[model samples]
Target: MKSSILLLAAAATLSAQIDRIEGERIRPHVKFLSSDLLEGRGVGARGGQLAAEYIAAQFAAAGLKPGGENGTYFQRVPLRSVEVEPGGALTATAGGKSISFKWLDDFVATSHTQEPTGQFDAEAVFVGHGIVAPEYQWDDYKGVDVKGKVVVLFTNEPPSTDANFFKGKALTYYGRWTYKYEEAARQGAVAAIIIHTTPTASYGWQVLRANGRAQPQVRRAAGEPALTLAAWVTTDAGAQLLGLAGRTVEEMLQASDKRGFKAMPLGKIHVAGKFNFKLQDIETVNVAGVVPGSDPKLSSEAVLYSAHWDHLGIGQPVNGDPIYNGAIDNATGCGLLIEMARAWSSMEPKPLRSGWFVAVAAEESGLLGSRYFADHPMLPAAQIAANLNFDSFSPYGRVKDAIMTGADRTSFFALVQSVAERHRLSIKPDGHPESGGYYRSDHYSFARVGIPAFSINMGGEYEGRPSDYAAQKAKEEGSTYHQPSDEYKASWDFSGMEQFARFGLALGIEIGNLEKIPPRVDAK
Candidate 1:
C-alpha cells in the first residue's frame, strides 16, 4: 500500500512536468522553421542551410556540446540532385495502337544521366505487385521472361483476408514502391512503372505528380547499370495499358488479391520517353549536438534523436503557392526536438548515457543525412544505444495512444511503452503499418546497421473527440500532405504535440539511464 501511494505521487509529479510543455513555447519554433523564408527547407537550397543554422542555434541554446566530427555541430553530407525533365513526348505503342501519355498529367519518368538519349522498344508485362517472396511462396515474376522488357507493377502488395497472406491488412516490405523498383532491377527489366491508386498507395496521384513532376531526385553519384527509366503512372494509364490485353484493371487487381497469380503480357508494346537530366553536386549539413552523460564510463555511449529538416523546396505551384512548408511533416518534429533538448538541459538529474540530437538533411529525397552519419558516426555503432526518430507529428489535441512505426521490430520497444504507460499514456504499433512507415524514416537508417530504432507519431483516440477521430483526421491530412497547402497554421492545437514532447523526453531519459544496451537481433 505504501509503495502504491509512492507510485501515484510519482505519476502526479511526472504529469505536472509534462504539462510544462507550453504551446506558446513550441509555437514560435514551428512558425520560424516552417516560414516561407525557409522555402520548404529543400535540399541544396538556401532555406535548407538556414534551417540547419537555426537547429544549430537551438542546440547551442540548449547547452548541448558539439558531437559532430571535429569541433563542430555540422556534418557535411556530400549530396547531388538529378533533375529529370520531359525532353519530348512520352509515347507508348501497344496492341498495334500508339498513344502518347502526358508527362505531368499521366506519367512521371526519371532516368540516369549516363544515357544522353535512348529508347527502349521492349515487351510489356503486367507483373502483379512485382514481388518474389520465397517465404510466402509468392512470386509475381516466376516463370516470366522479363529480361530486356519494360514491366508494369502494382504499387502495394496484394490484398489478403487471411492472416497468413502478406500480413493481412498490414503492408510488408514487399508492398513498398522501393521494393517494386528493386525487384524490377533484379529481374533485368529495362524499366518499370508502378500503377498508383489512392486506396492502394495511401495518397492521391497529386502526391506522385508533385513528387516527380518538378522535384529533383537526390542521387549520390553518376552511377551506371541504370534502368532506361523508372516511372509511375495513374490508374487511368494502367486501365488503358491493361485494356490492350482485353483485360480490365479491376480484374487484374482482384486477381492479385492473394496467392497464385501469373504475369500477363501486353503484346507488341514499346515504351519510350525523352528525359532531360541536369545533374549537379551539392552539400547539405546534418546538425548534431550532444548532452554528455554525467557518468564518465557511460559518456561514450549515446542515444540518438533525429528529425529530418528538409522538404520539397519550390515545386510546381498550386493556386500560386509552390513552397512545401512541410510544417507538420517535419517542422513540428524539429520543434519537438528543440523542446526536448531544453527540458533535458535544465533537468537536475542528467541522463547517465549521452544523448545526441541529429537534425538531418535530404530526407525528402532519401535518408541521405542519416545515411552519412550512420556510415561515419563519432561513436562506434556497437556503443550506440538506440535511435528515436520523429517525423510529421500532428498538432491536434492530446491523444490516448502514441503511434510508434518501427517499435514492434525490436525488443527495446517494450521499454518505450513502459515509459509512456508510467505517464498514463498507451502506446501502440502504427495504425498504417501497411504504408511501410517503419522503413521510411531516418531511424531506419540507424536500424539497418543493427541499432534498435523507433519512429513515433502521436495519434489514436483524441481527447474530447470520438474514439476513431484520429483515424478520420489522418485521412483528411493525407490529401494536403505533400502539397503546397502544407503550410503552418496558427489554428493548429498543440495539446497533442505537448503530450508527445513530454512523452518523448521521458522515454529518452529512461533509455538514457538504463545500463543494459538495447537488444539487437541475434544471428544464429
Candidate 2:
C-alpha cells in the first residue's frame, strides 16, 4: 500500500511537470512569431510565409501528421489583389444636367472577381433599408425588379418607435454591408452603393476608407459574375446625390425605416469614369497538420483547432515604431496552438479522435485563409467533429472566467462550461455582440458551412467589476490592438496564459474523447 501511494504521488508530479514544460514551450514560439523580425506576418509578404513555415515546423515537431492535401502541411490559397486607381469619378445625370464626384472623397468601388476592368451604365433606384425579412413583414424589394439597375440603400434598420419593423435599434445580418451587397446581387442589380452615416456604421468615413482600401476576398469559384462594383457614399455625398433628383436624404431615410416602404427610383442616371485597376496576383497559405487517433476505428474522425497567425503586418509607423507585432491580438493565440499540440502529443494513451491544428493567414483580411480552407478542406467537413479557435489571450494577469462568444447557439457551451468550472473559472457570453465579433473571426467561415466552430477568449473582467467597466478595459487594450505598439511587452504576466492553455487542452481532450458530436442550438 505504501509503495502504491508513492507511485500515485510520483505520477501526479510528472503530470504537473509536463504541464509546466508545455507552457514554457509556447512562450518562445509566440515571441518569435510576433517579433519585429516577422513584420506583423502580413499576407503575401515574406514574413507571412515565414510565419506559416514556423507553424508547420512546430506542428511537425509536435508529432502531428500533415493533414493538408499532397501530403504537405500547407494548403495554398489563390487570392487576387485588385487595387482601385485613385481619382476615379462617378457622374450622375438628371434633368439633362450632370454632377460628378471623386473617389475616396465621395465614393469607392471594387470587384469580387479578377476582372481588370468593368463598367455599369444603369438607372438608379432607392431601396428602403435594402432588407427583406419575412419574419419582420418588411420587404424593401417588394414589387421592385431592380434587375440591371443601380440600387441605393440606407445603412441601418428601422427605429424602435416602429415596433412592427426590424428589431428597432438592433442591427441584424440585414444591416451588414455584406448583406447589402448580396441582396443587390440577388435582385439582379448591376451595382450597389450604401449610404453611410456615423451612427449607423459605428465609425467615421476614414474608418470606411481604411477597411475598404484592403483587397477583399471572394471564394474563387468559376463562372460566377462578380458584382460589377460596390461603393459607400458619405451622408453628405448621399444628400448631394439625392438633391440632384429633387429629394432630401433625411426624408428618404425616414420613409425607408417605416413599414410598407416601397422602392423608388431617384430618376437620376450616373456614369462612372473608366476605372484603372491595379492587379497583383498573390498566394497565401494555411498551415495544417493532423495527429492521428490511437484508436484505429476512431482515427477517421478529427477535431480541429485554429488560430490566425497574421496581423496588420508592417504598416504606417505609430510612435516611430513600424512593426504591428500583434503580441496579444494573435501571437498569444498562436502560442496557445503550439502549447495545445504539445499537450496532446504527450498524452499517455493519446486521444480517441485525431486532432488537426490549422494556423491560418489573412484573418485580418476578413478570415480569407479560413474561408479558403473551409471551401476546399482536406478532410470532409462532415467528417470533422468540431473546431476550436483562439484569437487573443487575456493580457490581464489571471482571470476567473473564460468568455465564449456564440455560446447559446451550440451545445459546446456545456463542454466549455464544465471545463471552466473545473478550473475555478466561470463561463460567460461575449459582452459586445453588437461588434459582430463572432462573425468577424476565422471560426465564422466554418460555422457558416455547418461545422460547429467556436471562439474562446480570455477577459480582463474581474469578479466585482461591472460589465461596462470590463468593456472599457477591453477597449483600452483594443486601442493598442492593431497599432505598431502591439509588440510583446516584458511586463506581460504569463500566469494567466498557463491557466488558459490548460483549459484549452482539457476542452480539446473532452471533445476528442466524446462519443457524440455537439449539435448546434436549434434556436440559433
Candidate 3:
C-alpha cells in the first residue's frame, strides 16, 4: 500500500514536470523551428542545412555527448541529385514494329545509384504482382527467370474481394514499390517497372512525376552492381504494351490475384530508353546525441529515438509565401525529442541504459538519413535495444488515446499502453491501415535490420467533441499534411503533444532501467 502510494505521487510529479517543460521550453523551440525563416526545412537546400546545424547546436546545449561515429555529432550522408532531361522517351519494339511513349504522360524512370548515366536492354516479362512471401503462400515469380530482363509488375496487392490470396482489404509489404524493387533485384532482374493507377497507388501520377524529378536516395551495394534500371509506366502505357503482346491489363491483374500465378511473357517486346541527367554531389547531416546511463554495467546498451527534420524546402510560392514550413510534419516531433532529452537529463536518478537522439535529414526525399545511419551506425546494431520514431504529433488538443503504427508486431506497445493508461489516455490501433504508413518512415529501416522499432502518431479520437466529428477534422487537417500551409497555427494545442512526450520518455526510462533488453515479439 505504501509503495503504491509512493508510485502515485511520483507519477503526479513526473506529469507536473512534463507540463512545465512543454509549456515553457518545448513550445518556444517549436515556434522557432516552424518560423518563416527556416524556409520549410527542405532537403538539400540552405534551409535544410540550417535546420541540421540548429539541431546539432541544441544537442550540444543539452550537454548530451555526441553519438555520431568518429567523435562527431553529425553523420554526413552522401546524396546524388539527378534531374531527368526533358523529352526522355521509352520505346517498345517487336517483330520490327515499334511504339514510343513520352515521359510523364507514358513512363518514368530513376536510377538508384550515384551514377548519372546508365543503360540496359532486356526482354520484358509481365510478372503480375511480383510478390514472393511464404507467409502469404504467394509467389508471383514462380518458375520465371527475369535476369537481364524488364519485369513489369502491377501496383498494389491482390484485390480485397479475393479472400484466399493476400490480406484482401489490407496491404502487405509485398505491395509497396520498395518491396517490389528489392524483390526484383534479388531475382536478378536487370530492370523493373510498375504499372500505376490512381486507385491502386492511392495517389495521382503527379506524385510520381514530382518524386521522379528529384534525385533518389541510394546506398552503394559494395560489389553488387546496382540494378540497371527501375521505372514506372502509366496505366494506359502498360495497357498499350500489353495489347501489342495480345494480352489485356485486366487479365494480367486478375491472374496476379490468383494463388498460382506465373510470370507471363509479353511476346518478346523490346524496350530502350536513355537517361540523361546532371548529378550533383551533395552532403546532408544526421544530428545525434547520447545520454549515458547511471549503472556502470548496463550503460553500454542503447535506445534510439529518431525524427526527421527536413521537409519540402522553398517551392512554388503560395500567395507569395515560398517556404513549405513543415511545422507539424516534423518540427513538432523535433521539439518533443529535445524536450524529452531535457527532462531525462534533469532526472535525479539517471537511467541504467544510454539513450541516443537522432534528427535525420532527407526523410522527405526518402528515408535517406535513417537508411544511412542504419547502414553506418555509430554503434553496433546488435547493441541497440529498440528504436522509437515520431513523425508528427497532435496539435488539435489532448486526446483520450494514442495510436501505435506497428503495435501488434512489437512488445513496445505494451510499455506505451501502460504509460498511456497512467496518464488517463487510451492506446489505439492505426485507423488507416491501408495507408501502409508503418513502412513509409525511418523506423522501417531499423525494423528491416531486426530491430524492434515502431512509430507513433496522434490518436484519431478527440474529446470535448463528437468522436466522428473529431476524426473528420483530423483527416481534413492532415490533408494540409505536406503542403506549405502546414505552418504552426496559433490555435494549435500542445497538451496532447506533452502527453505523448511523457509516454515516450517514461517508456525510454523504463527500458533504460531494465536488466534485459526488450526482445522483438514473435510476429516481429
The best candidate by TM-score is: 1
Q: Which ten residues in a row have the lowest lDDT in candidate 3?
A: 210-219
Best prediction by lDDT = 1
TM-score of each: 0.92, 0.84, 0.87
Each model's lDDT: 0.79, 0.76, 0.77
Query: Could you give candidate 3's per-residue lDDT for residues 50-160 as a string of tens digits?
Result: 888888888888888888767878898888776666656678888877889887667777765556666766788989888888877778888888888888888778766
Task: For model 1, state the Cα shift of residue 448 in Å.
Answer: 2.0
Report the candidate with higher lDDT, 2 versus 3.
3
Candidate 1 global CA lDDT score:
0.79
Tens-place lDDT per residue, model 1, 207-247, is 88877633334452544345767788899987887776677
Write candidate 2's Cα lDDT for 255-326 as tens digits: 997777999888765645456567777888999988888878877888889999988776546568767788
> How much is the lDDT of residue 42 in candidate 2?
80
- Give me the displacement of residue 403 in model 2, in angstroms: 2.5
Each candidate: how many clashes? 1, 0, 2
Candidate 2 regions with alpha-carbon error over 4 angstroms: 1-27, 91-108, 155-172, 202-206, 212-216, 219-222, 239-254, 267-273, 314-325, 463-478, 481-485, 518-524
Backbone clashes in model 1, listed as residue pairs: 171-434
